[model samples]
Target: MRLAGNLLLAVLVLAALAIAATYWRAGQREAAARAAYPPLGQILDVGGVQVHAHVTGAGPDIVLIHGAGGSLRDFTFDLAARLSDRYRVIAFDRPGHGHTDAADTAGRRFDAPRQQAALLQAAARQLDIARPLVVGHSFGGSVALAWALEQPGDTAGVVLLAGATMPWPGTLNASYRINSSLLGGALVVPAITAWVPLPYARQVLAGIFAPQPMPESYPAEFGLPMALRRGLLRANARQVNGLRPHVVEMSGDYPGLEIPVELLHGDADEIVPLHVHSGPLSALLPDAVLTVLPGVGHMPHHAMPDHVTAAVDRVAERAGLR
Candidate 1:
């Protein structure tokens, strides 16, 4: 009986040690991530939330919103910088991603694309951005659509790069499901944040851009560590897991939109299937155009920048910004 009790005590001690270790490591990693990828833009206070906006170049305005688990760095890596030459580019770190704080004081998760669009529009107004061409990738695409639907007069045009438009059929990945839950966010998130290595993060990114080579400089430039921060990880999971229902509701509103939309998607994109999103989206809008790359993957902005650039240029012309 004593031996059994001792064994139980040992198990309790080990579990306690593991929890303590995870907490300590999580703190360390969070600090390191902040130091490694310091905000590259000005933090503007919009309502109660803080938004990070990177503005550059001088021409007609172009706002860029990145996908899930991404920051303005995703655009700055290449697309935003390149576009800046021809347009005034404003890349935003969406609420709950990168340095942007979720402004919902009620502590409600800022997962709905409409909510995100409202926040981003408020931020753009503060920066004096008016009727800019908006570009959204992946999850950002959903936000762009919402922006156009909610305030059609304010958006000049839209460019969707492998945008997530339609309500996808399957459940989110197991990791997103787990981390989105209260218990998982409280426990599993911290554990992953604490113990996940850079290579593992890279592996996940590679999968996102599968069938296409990850740009060699992407890991460093895109700030992988920022995405792994505990708060951001939980926020991303919540947004991703809750996205489908929101998309379903939003998809019905697309037919009423009047703004010009140019969608560039890869036929090989497994992340956001081409047939499911851009394909149907084109048929829904009166002025929408869809371009399918023959053998590209999800990261078309990186894999085929020239095509993306041309699409943006076409939108600019259509919007009379050219």
Candidate 2:
């Protein structure tokens, strides 16, 4: 019995050591990530949450919101610069995604699209962004929709580029399901933060951009390492895993959004399929123009930037900003 007790104690000690090592590694990685990619935008307080915003250029106001698992850097990289020439471009890190502080560490507080929209709108009000042309990519589209729905009078129009605006029939693949769970948060997320290599991230990015290749410089400039921080990974997982229901609720309000809207998607996009989202959204929106890129993927903005710019121009014209 004494020998068995010793073995059990030995196992417990080994397990404890392993967990400690994991946490130490995770912390080191997080520090390295932050040092590598410090916040490029200013931080503002929005209802107890610290929101990160980057504003540039001058003209009519234009707000840019990036998708899940992305920071505002995604926009600041190229699109924001592209739009900045003509419009005062304002980009923000959505709550829990970038430098912005999540109201709850587990990321439940802003899981609802409306919550994200309300918080971002408050930040915009702080910036004095009046009736801006709001642009969103992927999950950010849902938030843009919410902003228009909740404050129609305040928003001039919306531009959804490969947006995840509608609910889908199937469950998200295993990675999202596992990562969003309690067990995943306690064990898996830290491991991923500590050791998920760059190669794997590249692989995932490849998949996200599928047929269309990810720009070689994208990973470094995008701060992929910083995005893999444990808290952020967990937050992204929770927000995306819990998103479908909010989409279902938000979809019902689509027809009521009477503002000028622009929808653009790649026919080949698999992440937020064209058929499932933009295709159907064009018909639902009271005044929307859908632009389908024949052979592009999820990164439609990157793939066909001119088309995206044209769509913005159309929205501006329709909203009488042009």
What TM-score should be assigned to candidate 2? Answer: 0.97
Error of 1 at 91 (Å): 0.4
- Across residues 69-159, which tens digit of lDDT does each residue of candidate 1 receive? 9999989999887888888999999889999996566676567899999998999999899899999999999998988888899889999
Tens-digit lDDT track of model 2 for 1-322: 9999999999999998988899899999999989999889788887668899999999999999899899899888789888888999999998888898867444447777899898899999999999999999999999889989999988899999999999898889787888889999888999998888888987887788878899899999998888888888877888899999998998899999999999999999988999999988898999998988999999888888888888898899899998
lDDT of each: 0.90, 0.89
Who wins the lDDT comparison? 1
State every prediction's TM-score relative to the real structure. Answer: 0.97, 0.97
Local lDDT at 156 for model 2: 91
The C-alpha local distance difference test score for the whole of candidate 1 amounts to 0.90
TM-score of 1: 0.97
Worst 10 residues of 2 by lDDT: 102-111
